[model samples]
Target: MIVIRTPGRLSVRLQPRVLAVGTVCLLLTLAVGVLAVGHGEYPMSPTDVLRTLTGGGSPAEEFIVTQLRLPRLATGLAVGTALGLAGAVFQSLVRNPLGSPDVLGFTQGSATGALVVVAVGGGSAVLAGAAALGGIVTGLLIYLIAWRRGVHGYRLVLVGIGVSAILTGVNGYLMTRVPLMSASRAMLWLTGSLDGRGWSDAVPLLAALAVLMPALLACAPALRMTELGDDAASGLGVRVQRTRMLLLAGAVLLVALSAAAAGPVPFVALTAPHLARRLTRSPGVTLLPAAVIGALITVLADQVALRALPGQLPVGVVTGVIGGGYLVWLLATERRAGRL
Candidate 1:
């Protein structure tokens, strides 16, 4: 362990393995992002993509990269980063493998909100707003229901599961009641694609992360302490409930932003933290590594959906398939270990 300090103002303790994992994940995310940019009908070379990004390419390359692919790539990066940070915070706080945005129904809330807009013929423009509102509302509802004097991990997880199931039903009912065209649009949104995305869709999410990520990072010590249990954490001078509330608020907003931007792209939130933890073999919260892995996973899944398949499948479909397999493997592994 090496400690870097700027006199009395700042100090950072670094773990070699964790640092290495985060570095690798960051590099992989950039590589996948480049591949995504260079891909599609135009198909620029990596050299062309890099050169164009640096402002030294042909007009056509400039237009294609700047106008077409960059916005989508930027959106995917932000969404992934948000989900990863949210997942790391939630999973660490709840101490449950099942504690994720999708499992907790925040994503479902976003879908419900978007479907409501479409059902009322509000069109695509306001769908992001509606989705964000839904997620925020759902998060609040779950938090309220889970609070009994103070929130417990098991109680929070149970409340989330129940709320998620109810929201799933509500989403299905709304889907059935909508018009055929609206239903089709809702289906696509629910599947979470980056299709037809531009700067407008990317900015709000990026802005939300810009505001939220730093606050969450500042709370990282308390977050890791809370994982040691509330009693112990409180004894250590951590305001356990306050920490929980702040973390919950940040996680919810992150989820809302990602859902609004990308329609709740799956598995990235659930898998990123775990993958980061496994890679680093770290017992503490792996926020930076998780965020990097989340970006890599989302971007890579999107690239697969766009380029590796015959008919461009939705990014969510690719993630769902991968996450499902991973989920099953996870369940079996837990069962055999008698932890399930």
Candidate 2:
């Protein structure tokens, strides 16, 4: 661990292996991103894709690469990175592998918010704002309800599961109330597609990630200390409750913004951190590696969604199928190990 300290400010300890793993994941993410941009219906070669990106291509190539593909790529990367970071925070805080925004009702809450906006004939901006509000509200509610002497991970998880079930029902009811055309639009968004996404959709998520990433990184040491138990964390000059609240709030915002940008793209959050931890062989959650892996998974999944299927499918459908299977496998493995 290499510790960097500026007196009275946050100190971060860097692990060499974690940095190596993050670098590898980022390289893989770039490779996948290239494949995603180059292998679409227009079928630009990697060289052509690079040329277009570097402003050296023809008008048609520019339109295809810059206008059509780049925005979608940007949104996918941002959303994936946000989800991955949020998932790492939650999983670490709860000290449970299953802790994630989707599992903890945050995503469903955002979906519910967006669905309500759709039902009321709101525009995209309104929908995004409402989604963020809904997620933040739901997170606060869950935290309050889960609090006794303090928030316990198991209690929070249980409460979140119940809240998720309720929100799922709410989403279903809202769907039924909307007109067919509106319902179709809502359903498509809810299923989470990168289809037709432009810079308008991508920009806000990028901005949010830009601000939140550093804040989370600055808090990383405190977060890691919290894993040693509240008493130990407090003994080490960490304010446990305050740190938990801040981290939880940060995680919720990341999920809300990502959901707003991409519709609750499932399983990225739940899968990315665990995969990162395994890849790094890290005892603690590896945030940067998780973010990179999340980006890679999302970009590759979008490629498959657009090209591999007979008809273009929503990106969420592909992720949902894979994530659901992973969820089942996780349960089975945990049960076998007597960890459930």
Candidate 3:
């Protein structure tokens, strides 16, 4: 740990392995991003893509790269980064591998909110607003319901799982009650497509991340200290409950904004942080590395979904398949280690 202290303010510590892993992941994300931009139906060469981005290409090339592809690419990166950071915070808080927005009912709650708006003929903005509202409400509900004297990690996970099941059922019922066209729209949204996304979709997510990520990072030292146990953390002068609440709030906001932008893309949050941890060999979560990995996975998954199938499938479908397999493997590994 490399601690840098200013005279009056709090100190920031950097780990060398985390920095190295983050750099590698960032490079990989850039490579995947370039590939994603260059491999579409109207494929452009890497040189052409770069030229277009740098304002040196012709009208059609510029249109394809800037107007058509860049927005989707930007949305994917922002959504992935938000999800990964949120997931890292939640998993660290709960001290469980399975603790994520998707598994903990927050995603389902957001989906339910959006589906309700869509079913009632709301437009994109309204739907996004509703989704964020629903996620925040659900997160609060889970936190309150799981609290006895205070929240326990296992209890919180269990409550979230139960709440998630209920929300899933509610979403399904709402789908059945809506008009066929509306239902189709809802289904497509639920599957989490990046199709036809523009700056309208991408910008809000980017803005949200810009605000929330720094707050999450600011809470990082408290988060790490809290992992040493609440009593120890308190003894070390960290305000344990306040720190947890602040971290939880940051995590929820990130999840809400990401879900609003991309309709709850599955498992990126759940999988990316763990992968980052492994890569860095870090005892605690590596937020920057996790964010980079998430962006790479999302961009790569979107690329595969677009090209690997007869029709363009939703990005969530590809991630769901991959994440399902990862989930099974995780379960097996945990069982072998007597952690399950």
Candidate 4:
């Protein structure tokens, strides 16, 4: 008797479950965003929000929903997804759950770039492009410097931290040198405000994500192999350096897109992958799931921030409160385990 083993494509076989979860998360995000649209001082109902979105509401309501809230909601979702996907990619490539754009300074680089553009009186679109370029440049520089034969996760983290500190100083100096009014506006952007965001702001973010996410997803198989130790991966015919470079580039692109959209909303990129890994109980971070979780967290957080207080709070503030607390807890736990 002869025995045969069947080979299967794990990723494709899991596609249905992945698709189901993604669809559910997307619907939930839409529902939350819709409800949030109706929630400010003017207060439209969900039906009103839908009617406004679909061109059936009163002009005033339409303006509020379509012009004001819609963009904010869309930006929140787009930024969240970008950060989440970036976080997942970084965490997987580095084989460390803590490897995220925010943690590693890519966000700071993007922020610095955007700040320079804003300080120089550039338009918002230009500012976004500048931010993306900054993030990519900084990420590539760090990767190149950290590449000792190949990339090491620890070296990357160290270089990133240094880069972050340097950029932060530059950002502060730029803010201080600018005229008061311009500085004030730049500060708002720095703090990640959704105020006055219209369809215009939403357009670029959505477009970037549309173009970038597919490319990142296509890199997933290589990402998985690279997560196996470099030696093991190389033995299995993976071109470790080339694959890692590609992965790093994809991660940087996603991160830059996110930072440009939302002014480097802190901690989302740092925390979302860990949260996704924990939630799915997966051995490693998966990009698609992480993006979904990131979108949900931000969309819901924005909803809470909008209505939780007597006045509107910046969505970043909401994420900061939760993410900061989690970071503290994580540190404490690591210390207790003698791992910090």
Candidate 5:
């Protein structure tokens, strides 16, 4: 007699391929991060940095890497992961490749909220919370206004673009009202900087990751069902509208938290998912893989901004340049395929 048995397990199961890709990315990022530690203005050898990392270096070397570089690296990792995952979720939820908080005005709304708090001289924590609320509110408003016969992806995107433009104007106008020194600082924040970031900045970002990452992971099964269209998803007993709302809220929270921590580092949310899809050849945007790629991009870009440039360049500048090129290439490729 032959018996078929089901294995009982409470362990997390990851695809062997996905695990392999993730491992490669993690290793690459670590190697690049180590290289980055050696390329700053006051250069330290990789050996010295490694020793400092392992807690056996001189005081100055320890101060440079552990105190300065480590915090910046940590911030990059957290913020990039947040943006990338947020982008993947938004894109999958809306079923549009271009759907990202940065493009859809969510980050713009967050920026406006943070700017308001800054203008009013509020604390960073307050700014972060307000920014999150503002992002959610803006996304909801866009969804509501774009809801005609039903929510069309193109219509939602257009409405979001309009909202983003208005928010950009408001951000610019608000900056004009602040004093010059404060305005300069605000401008740097808008452009996104990891300079002078410390353990303090990591706290809120870590908190957001702790809260939202699991929520997103939990919703993955529902989101997977959602890809089958609302009627089909409803047939499968998924609460379609509720699932969308939850996903949107999670995405907004992730983007807002990252923006609050790093001040709107652009395009990670827009480009990372697409890059992941291409890399994995996955039928859809894979959130975890995208987040890993985004973290790598941000950390490496920050390193370039810090070391390769003649002077300090904000991380956003590097991202914008690379992301813009990617966008152009995507458009060109789509046009060639008659899909644009």
Candidate 6:
């Protein structure tokens, strides 16, 4: 740990490996973004993509890059980053890898909300809002149900699993009650499509991040402290419950926002932080690194969905397949270590 201190005696510790991992992940994300932006039905070279982005390409290239693909990429980046950040904070706060919003049923809540909108004849424009509301409500419910004096990691995890299973059933029931067409729409959204997404979809997610990320940074120091058990954190002058609540609140909002934008693309939330941790070899949370990996995985998965298959597939499909495999591997590894 390298500590930098100011004249006022405030110090920040920097981990070199974490910094290096973040940088590498960021570069990879950008490279994949370029690739995703350049290749489509009307493929452009990387140079054309760069030139178009920088205001130097022809009108057609600009149309394809700017109007066609950029917004989708932007939305993907925002959703991935949101999930990654949320996952890191949630896992860190709960001290459990299975504590992600997806596993905890927050994403199912979001899906239920969007399904409600579909059932009510609402359009895609309102689906994100409904999803966000549902996720928030579900988060509050989880907190209340899990709170006993204060929330414990293990108890919260157990309660969240139960809530998730219930929400899964609810989502299935809601799907059956809707009309066939509406149910189809709901199914696509539940599968987490980025199809036809535009600037409007990207803006709200970016704005939410703008407001919420600083709060995450502010909570970081305390978040690390909270990792050292409640007793130790409290001994170190940390307000354990307060810190936990703040972290949970921030994470929930992030999960809600991402689900709103991208229809709860699975496994990004659950896998990105763990991948970041392995790359960084860091003990605590690698929030920034996780965010980068999240963006990378999302954009890369979307690319695979678009180009590697017979037809374009929903981004969620690719993520779900990849994330499912990663989860199996993780569970096996943990089981062998007697930690499962």
Write down the TM-score of every candidate. 0.94, 0.89, 0.90, 0.85, 0.85, 0.93
User: Who is ahead in TM-score, 5 or 6?
Assistant: 6
What RMSD does model 5 have?
Answer: 4.1
lDDT of each: 0.87, 0.85, 0.85, 0.77, 0.80, 0.87
Model 3 misplacement above 4 A: 1-13, 323-340
State the number of backbone clashes in model 3: 0
Pairs in clash, predicted candidate 2: none
lDDT of 2 at 133: 85
Q: Provide C-alpha RMSD values for all models, in order.
A: 2.3, 3.4, 2.9, 4.6, 4.1, 2.4
In model 5, which regions exceed 4 Å deviation? 1-6, 9-17, 121-133, 143-158, 324-340
Colliding residue pairs in candidate 3 = none
Pairs of residues at least 3 apart in sequence or in different chains that clash in candidate 6: none
Cand. 4 Cα-lDDT: 0.77
Report backbone clashes per prediction. 0, 0, 0, 0, 0, 0
**Better model by lDDT, 3 or 4?**
3
Per-residue lDDT for 291 in model 2? Answer: 85
lDDT of 4 by residue, 1-340 (tens): 2233457633334544555666777788788888878877798888877877888988888777777778888888888898888888888877776787877888788878887887778888898788888898899888888889788777888888888889888888988888898887777767775666667766777897898789888877777877778788888888878877877887798778777777777777777777655444455557887798688778777777777865787778788777556656766664335232
- lDDT preference between candidates 3 and 6, better one: 6
- Model 1 scores a C-alpha lDDT of 0.87
**Candidate 2: tens digits of C-alpha lDDT, residues 141-195:** 9999998888877888999999999999999999999999999999888888788
Error of 2 at 68 (Å): 1.6
What lDDT does candidate 6 reach at residue 3?
Answer: 88
Comparing 2 and 4 on lDDT, the stronger one: 2
Candidate 1's error at 125, in angstroms?
2.2
